[model samples]
Target: MEEDFVLMKGNEALAEAAIRAGADGYFGYPITPQSEVMEYLTAAKPWERTGMVVLQAESEVSAINMLYGGAGAGKRVMTSSSSPGISLMQEGISYIAGAELPVVVANVVRGGPGLGTIQPSQSDYFQATKGGGHGDYHLLVLAPSSVQEMADFMPLAFDLAFKYRNPVMILSDGAIGQMMEKVKFQPQRPRMKDEELPGWATTGKTPDRERNIITSLDLDPYRQERFNRKLIEKYQKMKEEEVRFETFQCEDAEYLFVAYGTSSRICQKSVQLAREKGIKAGLFRPITLFPFPEKQVGALADQVKGMLSVEMSAGQMVEDVRLATNGKVPVEHYGRMGGVIPTPDEIVEVLIQKFIGG
Candidate 1:
């Protein structure tokens, strides 16, 4: 039997879930709509009861560096912030990825080119999945569309981060961060018994071995290439195994709408409206943005002649939609930005025009 669920905001759930997941440390600076996350944890029992270290760092830069230190110590850890804070942490995130450290960071993204807005937006799509900071690397970007999924995916983020020895990101938005919904919570999982963490973790060594080192710096070019190859292999495995998505009314529909994060909530409503209007419309929502649900999108393209992308931005994910549709199906985009969420009615109107125009 499972415990009864409760309604909670996505950011609160994330904080609670991270606590329940046995995360040993959390370091972050405040930024809205994500500020509630740090607040929840800071005021909660995780620190007093579980010996977890939760700190509000002076800035995002310091917060992420603290995460690096915790990860190097072989402890489960997490950090949370909005776009501007995330931008500051990008340098640290890239460093964590290069060091092959298992760390989790949650970005409750607000609109931005530079402090564009404090409201929700999916404008960070490319930034989150395309190695936002620098170099040839990718963070496993998980986009949670609901409050339940927000809570549910926090532990999954940590598990995957540790499993691959790579950084993982929960790419959310202000709406999801602030919305309330019923969600069942599960007991924390026990630490893995079969596998001890890598020896490179900065755990103090026994007399039998020498001090271990963990870093991204490799002076030898050949050695650097080898390291890069190993990272690539891990990413490939994730691409094969970790891609995730949800489909609604996609089967037998003539048109498909693709969205993620908070945008999908509106898209879900659009699907309902489209159906009521007798338009054969459906939705494909990507939960994992990096190892994207391209296969599913491609399959849908074979059936649907037209596809439209709904995002909070003018068009970032539209590119991915085009790639998925292979230039065969005509893809369109509709959005609002600087904090305005695209309403379902708006999306439905777009679909009606595109589908009925022909």
Candidate 2:
């Protein structure tokens, strides 16, 4: 198949990918660092080409609920928002997860405790991975480090969502969302017809089949308990089979760097800088943050002397790395919150000071 390539902003790639991936609808409110997604979609006018629906919702809460409705109908749907906006959508996000709907969401993160700065940060790690919404639910989180991944993850996220009957999140940051890169867009796939919708879809009454109901509400405690158990089983299965991560210079390294998304890219550079200084530093980049590369990170703990989990947050993911390592090695966290990005040189210095000097 011929690949179509384009140089575009990461956010634009995301919108283009959704259209090319045959997404049925996108409903979202404008939020900085991620507003380009909706703007690109609106400018492209995908409805004219692929019959996709793009609506600008009044708020993030409304956007997420709109996505839920489209997803329940078995249509590919998605939304994008930045930090505070995502916070508003939490309740609706939980609802979608509870209903076991297949949809994709992109979070282009910014600094936050309240209405924080528009600059980049990875502070949302805890929110994205630790079931940000509510209950015993999880969104399959994908962390993309490049513009290429911004384009590529859209289709993959949709596929995974439908496979597990769950929602998926592309946890991007302002750095990647605004950066421009050359992306090789995948070949287009035709949209699914209403008749071709999956068996579980609530596509309205059909003469030959029983009515399909789509919802997350179960007033009965026992019935809801059963559903919760099913969701737990689904998450376990995903952890066992769908964990995705990347390793660099790990075959023979004494120290390790664990990160994801923008932080991972910076850590990759830090590893190189550390290696130049006669330090054996490897990088572990987790692609799937929820189904975290725990087992793999645990395995590395046995080989490395110490590790540092880098991020743009006040160290959210470092806790996960500590959990993954399980006290086998000394683990430390290094980062700047409020949208400050750390430098590779600074990261290597921290590694040396915290581990070797200490």
Candidate 3:
């Protein structure tokens, strides 16, 4: 039998779901909206009873380094923060990607330029999906629009991170992180083993067989080029295997809505309202930002008259949408910033103006 559903905030659900997924360690600093996740984990006794190692680091820099250490030790580890904290962790994140360690990071994004605001915002879209730190690497970025999705995506993030030997990120926002909604917990799979650790792990073995060295430094240009090629190969595979999206009433729609994370939730309501008004509006919600559902969106563009990219930022995913549509459809943007959110009614008006050419 399935478990009963209960209301939960996105951040709270994330913490609980990660614990259920058998994450062995967590390291993070306090940040608005996302801070509750750390609070929940600290209070839940997941560390004391399950032998999980939960630590509140002094800063985001220290927190991410802690994740690097835990992942290098072959332990399932995670961390959560908002935009500024995430910014601080970029160095560690890049290192994790280069070393091919599996670690999960959650960013309940707020507005940004520098010290933007505590309220909800989708401003981190580009940063999360486009290799925020340095190098030509991509993080598996999952955008959860609802609290329920927050719970559902946690284990998936972990699985993908380990499978790809790369960092994975849950890119939500303050709205989803702070808002309460119902969620049904799924039956979790058996706990994973540290044995899943690749041969690259430093197990401190005898000197006879071979010593494993985990470093991104390849002084030889040819070797460095080879490493880059291998990384690109994995990214190619990810593009094929990991793209995920949710479509609503898109089959015969005249207007398409492109949105993700908290912005997409409002888009859902807007689509419903448009239907009530006899306007053919549909929503294309990208669940994975990096392994973007570009092909699917391109297919939809062939049928739709136009597309609207909605976000809390000025325009980030808008660029990706344009790339996906390939200049086939008239793509427009509607958004708010500095922690303000676009309402369903506002989105409908934009649809009216853009689609109807009003």
Candidate 4:
């Protein structure tokens, strides 16, 4: 049993977790800091043991379309990429959302506007949570702050994907993706059988049943409006049922640091450092970013003097934090962008300077 635990980089753990989660297929293109996900999958060769198919598509565009096809057939499928790669997949992701197909995706994010450096970042918060592509839609986004979560989130994301019949994204960063940590493998799950496929799957049509034609196209304005409304209802359901977050030492704190993914890990350390300085500080980590944990942060506002949103980008998440706090308290934005990671001490001092003051 102990042998099931091993040290792995975040990307490697995510790859192993997918196979153990009974994923039917993975279609991905190589991208820095995230390519290891596909590399590990191909090397493990789960096809023999679990019958999972692993394919390397020629481009991010190709990979996402392959994911669309696999998912439309009711297969538990996934793909992963970094920032620019994810940007390329936007159109297809929107299409899958419109069709209401379930699939998991991991964005091991790096710094980016375009062709950004292969370094850790959390700049894609807006894109991931607020719909990167076209039209009205949302992808349930999970932010993993550690390698263990990189492994743990695969099955969770898959389950939520199927439950909502919408795309689920593991919004990771290069720091987490490349860093090594111990991961205990999940118990292996059996792949879904043909009999277990969902009713809406576009498998071969039987004579006794109506054909399942999966598509995102709706030329009629009235029908397109209906489709949009249905998607809104689904997003509302997710907001009600799927909001996930964590609070540390917030039970009795005067200041709060709200961050996610790699930034959350840094803020956790800052919390400890601030405590040593006689400042009552706590860390609020958002595990599910899409729902944005609005009510939770709003509730926390009454107890804290101020909140600082720390991120690996130029304060992208700060806007959400401000919206969540609802002007009850001052919510300041502090971050290091373009592949730079903020240190624990740096965050502590910034908190004091930003909200505490000399």
* C-alpha lDDT of all candidate models, in order: 0.88, 0.93, 0.90, 0.94
Flag the better candidate by lDDT, 1 or 3.
Answer: 3
Model 2, position 98, has a per-residue lDDT of 95
* Model 2 per-residue lDDT tens digits across residues 108-164: 999998989999999999999999988989999999999999999999999999999
**Which candidate achieves the best TM-score against the true structure?**
4
lDDT of 3 by residue, 14-36 (tens): 99898888888899999897999
Tell me, by lDDT, which candidate is best. Answer: 4
> Lowest summed-lDDT stretch of 10 residues in model 3?
188-197
Model 2, global lDDT: 0.93
Q: Tell me the deviation in Å of residue 291 in model 4.
A: 1.2
lDDT of 4 at 33: 88
lDDT for residue 10 in candidate 2, whole number 0-100? 92
> Global CA lDDT of candidate 1, please?
0.88
Q: Sort every candidate by lDDT, greatest first.
A: 4, 2, 3, 1
Candidate 3 C-alpha error for residue 133, in Å: 0.4
lDDT of 1 by residue, 111-163 (tens): 88898888898888898998988777999999999888888998999989988
Better by TM-score, candidate 4 or 3: 4
